[model samples]
Target: MIDLTKDGDLWTVTLNRPDKANALTEAMLEKLVDIAQDASAARCLVLTGAGRVFSAGADLDAARAGLATSDLWERLSSAIADLPCLTISALNGSLAGGAFGMALACDLRICARHARFFYPVMKLGFLPQPSDPQRLRDLIGPARTKMILMGGEKIDADTALAWGLVDRVVPQDQLRGTVDELSADTLSASPTHATAIKAMI
Candidate 1:
């Protein structure tokens, strides 16, 4: 399930199925894609999860049904990357599987202290979404990216922060506040100004 909350020019999209470790179904992934595509109108957009784990990636049943290799993952990540608004991935916990695409697409990423990061595609015998490797490489570099993708290393939050996989590692209780603080300037700036700045980068 997904929860979208809008406050003026800020849009927060949350994965709400904590019971499933926020694992995504095809319908849920489609909803996220639709939301990201529609989020261009906002000044800032935040992606996060409701529980301790951001996402365990696609739901087990869904993955077994061919969702693991679906092109929707690429479509969703592309939409997020193309958004004119400033985008942040406020990772509440561990990030894994197909969920990595959206997080890697974000302009900024901040994760909770307990969060772990991994994409076990190699171990699971699936290739990652098309854009994920380059996006991830852009953040943390090729060898390090391979350490996760090819070597199957599950990186902890501290290592993620140190390697540039995430921008900050904050306490779980402060995650939303941290996102709000980071978004303040973008939220207050004129849409044109913010968009232009993002474009210039």
Candidate 2:
């Protein structure tokens, strides 16, 4: 469900189950959390997906078999949020369901120009972890969060940028290069300043 790779200063964690829309299983979630928690030396931590969809969030089918979605989600999101270095959600494609929380927990989110950001919890008849809505609120605002979680508005890359949901958008072909540049720029700050600024922010 996930693949992790490290090259010098860059660490990337990718959701690999493209055929499954990158839906996260409990085990997958645990692994992701572990990766984030252990990423101290990396200058940049990137979360992305392998195929056309970034991640669908919790695996509903697994949940039917008793996967603890709320608990696992809380752990994973919290781990990402606490990463000391720059954390970027590199959305290669659409993001949906609980995956929105994953993206929001990152310090920055950059997406493909055509990618969509969807929240269908209300339509699916269940709310995500209690803290998820708040994370979304922190990124955008409570009002906009309500519009998505309650009012049922759909968001594309453009809309997400306008609402401050995503930090940048690039053509699909240029996404990797864009993220590479940004990662370099983020790491360009002096180590002390980077850590201090990150802490202060």
lDDT of each: 0.94, 0.83
Candidate 1 shows a clash count of: 0
Q: How high is the lDDT of residue 73 in model 1?
A: 96
Please give the distance, in angstroms, between residue 100's alpha carbon in candidate 1 and its true position after superposition.
Answer: 0.2
Cα deviation in Å at residue 125, candidate 1? 0.6
Task: Give one digit per residue, the lDDT tens place, for model 2 in 16-131.
Answer: 99998899888898898789789877778999898778987668888666563457777778888887888999999999887776788889999998898778877877767777
Clashes of each: 0, 0
Q: For model 1, where is the 10-residue window of minimal lDDT?
A: 186-195
TM-scores of the models, in the order given:
0.99, 0.93
RMSD of each: 0.6, 1.5
Which candidate ranks first by TM-score, i.e. highest? Answer: 1
The C-alpha local distance difference test score for the whole of candidate 1 amounts to 0.94
Which tens-of-lDDT digit does each residue in 1-201 have in candidate 1?
799999998899999999999999999999999999999888889999998999999999999999999999999999999999999999999999999999999999999999998899999999999899998898889999999999999999999999999999999999999999999999888889889999999
